[model samples]
Target chain A: MTETPSTGQPPEFPRPTAGPPEPTRPAAGPPETPRPTAGPSQPTRPTAGPPEPSGRSSARPSQPSPRSSGASPAPDSQSSPGPSGRSSARPSLFTPAPGAAPVGRMLLAQTLFEIRLLLRNGEQLLLTAAIPVVLLWLLTAAPVFDTGDYERVDFLVPGILALCVMSTAFTSLAIATAYERRYGALKRLAASPLPRWTLLLAKALTVLVVEALQVVLVGGLGLALGWRPSGSPLAVIVLLVAGTLAFAGLGLLMAGTLRAEATLAAANLVYLLLLVLGGVVIPLSGFPSGVRTVLELTPTGALADGLRSVLADGAGLPWGSVAVLAVWAVAGLAAAARWFRWD
Target chain B: MPPCDTRGMSTAPAVEITSLVKRYDAVTAVDGLSLRVAAGTLTAVLGPNGAGKTTTVEICEGFRRPDAGSVRVLGLDPWRDGAGLRPRVGVMLQEGAGFYPGARPVELLSHLARLHADPLDVPMLVARLGLESVARGRTPLRRLSGGERQRIAFAAALVGRPELVFLDEPTAGLDPQARRATWQLLDELRAAGVTVVLTTHLIDEAERLADQVVIIDAGRVLAEGTPQELTSGVSDDVIRFGGPPRLDVASLRAALPDGSSVKEVAPGSYEVAAVVDPRLLATLTSWCAANDILAEGLQVGHRSLEDVYLELIGAAAERTAP
Candidate 1:
């Protein structure tokens, strides 16, 4: 490739400004010749010539004589509009036109990348997917969870599913985002042209994708152990979506406000607390009568109970649980938006 | 390229700040500072640490909001028009500002490239920055050497083909070779008529690359001029030599030209400040010979940007010291 020649020059003292007597353009002009072929067709084409460089560095000795002849053809092509075959016909070099892909494509790319990162992190995978499946199997076999009225698998499956959604959406996302903020990853993205909402949506989408995998894995294992889900399809879908939105919103709220280590400790602590008292592992029915109402109002309790009613009892849409989740989702998201700090 | 009118007008300076003041709780980071960067020129903001250089640049990049001042980048307020301005501007933050520790160089660069209107060719940029070997590998960004990480950050900043690019300490930890490569790239950017502003603590970097240098200290601008203009402001030439301590300055001054001044700044080192010409040099040597004193390691040169920088910051520090 013609570009390779430019790359071969010694990078040291490459500019003429370093008290070197040699003409700077002799070093710069040859490499710049290949830029048009490399750049997208635009107004930048006209300025890709020797005169352009001289104009900017007028303080430097203008010595375009020796190398200008050798480099003339490159700018010649750039100056003559649309004459070169590649000039007018090529697609945009950088951004898609408005109403083209824009945010959708960027969001999709960010989501895919986020998923890749989540999958690559062994700890994230274990927490979001593996731990839930392992718990589902272990809990169903335990005699302590035997409630006498229903099969143990019937109760444990939906609870673990709710736990999985919370893990992926809240614990894992909060920790990751907090660390990203500490590392300036979020700040860097903020400086870019990507819309802020697209980044948030991409994170939500990543959580959803991971949660889907968790459902398939844990649900498949439940099926193997003779657990039957009797919920209406629409209710299960609504519960899963609402659960994810609520937990992820809470996760971001914490991550965006707290320091990374604090977020890490707090997220794991909340995860464990909800897994026990929020009815994911221990049913809310067993709790004392007074706090049971309050516990049911908590996001985790609402999600687990909602999932249980739909998936185990074959119930219609649990509007009470749905309403609770909607409140948490709206409140958590609003808080996060108000207080989020990229740095 | 000519500065594109992404905001429907192209005549504004690439960056303009008027009476910018930024305070962090009890400390003022930037105080009543104003600067204007002309379009299609390379300007370097030179300052010591804690001089508010980074804070000023961040405001221009729309990353920070100044407490009380106006900042216009390419005819648009950077904060109000960030969405519109970001596409046309590129920023390389200091301290490896926002890279994922686990991301490979190519993955991170391409992800950033998709965010702009007309990004440069990614592979070509990678090659240009001499990141081919690292880009081909899967080593995470945190695992790469400091210089390598810096190069990737630099590439990310330039990949957008922006009309105005802001670089913060672009060559802080780079080796000599890598530093030179970065200078070459800045030159090319200027040739393309892209307005470039860089903040650095290195005086030589500002001297070599900047068309205009603004020396800032203690949250305010100390001086602003071309390197030559700043260096020439103090004296036309500084003559140095190693000689006897406690020289007779009275006799030397009497023998030398009317404007020439001599001082023994160190134990055995002497410096003479004057508009040095052949006659001045002859008079000094003749005076030294007649005094039976030997001048060794004699050298004549103009004041460097570093000398002026130190003097400016030193004076500022003394004034601010309680």
Candidate 2:
């Protein structure tokens, strides 16, 4: 409990620099020591010995004293290094080797903290998990729209899964990150030993974890609604990973560059547009050929088409759509890294 | 908490700045400011608001770049060697400006601790800062009081066992108890050979805690020395005594030596500014006795750090005014 001494409540510590040791407490009070101001000798450096009374008038006489109170402006405080037990030669008294934790451990710890934050936030849960589930139920069970010759549940599940990835990886991430930037958290981390790249990687991993739960929730809801999925498990996972990377990169770029309020407004707007125009709830076949060609080039459109062809039609690998998403992933991540601002 | 490279640093300053100049748009925030902080001692950059205190410290922390000057922290260029220094230095930005509103104290501290090679125990730090209640709560940081938020920022900064630390206004807006606790922790850190450089607007904070105080105003250093040197250099220690509220000031001025100024600064609080000697002391007391008054609480010390600060700031402002 030697370390416990400093951890005690602060009331015992005197303001003057002289109260360094536990024994100095008695000297800090008024009764034991005579006022230095009362005599000519009082002007001698009050930087040593007992703590002086804290008053504006007495401040000069009571200013920092060497190791008596543990600090002095004498510029030689380093020579003493008086707290005991350790050689003064070592670079740091706090640790034998002062440096950051191994990168993997740091990543793991930060990811856990991020997951806790996401799980606790009602809004984040609704957007990343609940909203997608609600969309699946409404589009299929409600009989709201004609989803083509295929079963309604079958046509909508893959598109809804794509929407789920977009929500978790992009919209939620961008808004959260924007606010973190606005609040000085990014700047604070920038100053810490944790590299900025590690922070970004950790955020991506957290998104992936949440996205997995999302797939389970939305897919489970789809299965209950009489939807039958077709597709290689490996191909489905690869498409999901590519979409997450693309969306996450763009989300982080907006958060690191834009104002939090602006990011909030813009992220929601982009989400709604992608849901309608990217063939999530609306079939891409309904658009004119020229318009469909452009929509197919968008990140959301590429992900939806890839997921739909693989799951709804069992059409196997869709190289063109996968290539589009990979391009977006590389380009989006590079742009984000180049332009991101910490504050 | 001694610096990572202590060799040859016995004489080397922990921080060295020369003619640093920084401007944002048209406003020159720091203009040709130069300073040196000796290793393992606490240096307080004391100034009034807008004195460029934050800007100067920010440059040292490598968060902001100085346009015209060079800054070296622990013998490494702060800008180019920032990553290398991160493990050895801790920085607390002003006012805890962006504590994640959604975070609680323990969660944030634990997260920051994980980023460092070694950190203090989270529970001990929480207890040391008197933040145990908030640490365990699920409440968001934004919902806490300003002082609580400040403590949280402080804990995060210190959790990483850094050899040196830069704290900006560490105790501003803190309640009295919390403020004292912060001061105590700083004292202990210095005792362990950790160097502390902080910026503050409170003159007492500098005088009480700093081994060296740098008084700045309008982006320039007006005075630099120990609190004693700054207060004592203006004159010999002042002669303060207590007597009647309205004693004859005009008559007393005439009785004192040619260079002395006499004033009753407050009711029954008399102060005499002069080259104090046995002769001057006798004359004042004899004069008081003849006037049928007792010089109670007679003391000899110069003015407080506040007076020196105000005098310097006022002069600086006047010189800069059109």
DockQ of each: 0.12, 0.26
List candidate 2 segments past 4 Å from native: A1-97, A287-297, A323-331, B1-9, B239-251, B262-272, B277-300
Query: For model 2 chain B, where is the 10-residue window of minimal lDDT?
Result: B1-10
Per-residue lDDT tens digits of candidate 2, residues B134-252? 88888888788888888899888788877789999999998887787787667666655677899988777787778789998778889999877887768644677788788777666
Error of 2 at B232 (Å): 1.4
TM-score of 2: 0.81
lDDT of 1 at A136: 83
What's the TM-score of chain A alone for every prediction?
A: 0.71, 0.73
Model 1 per-residue lDDT tens digits across residues B1-322: 2222342323668788899999999999999998988877779999999999999999998988899989999899988988888777877889656887678899888888776645667887786667899899989887899888888998888787777888999999999987877876675566556678999998877877777899998788889987767866466466777888887776676655567788887988988887554334545554555455678877655566788899889898898796
* Maximum-lDDT candidate: 2
TM-scores, each model vs. reference: 0.81, 0.81
Docking class of 2: acceptable
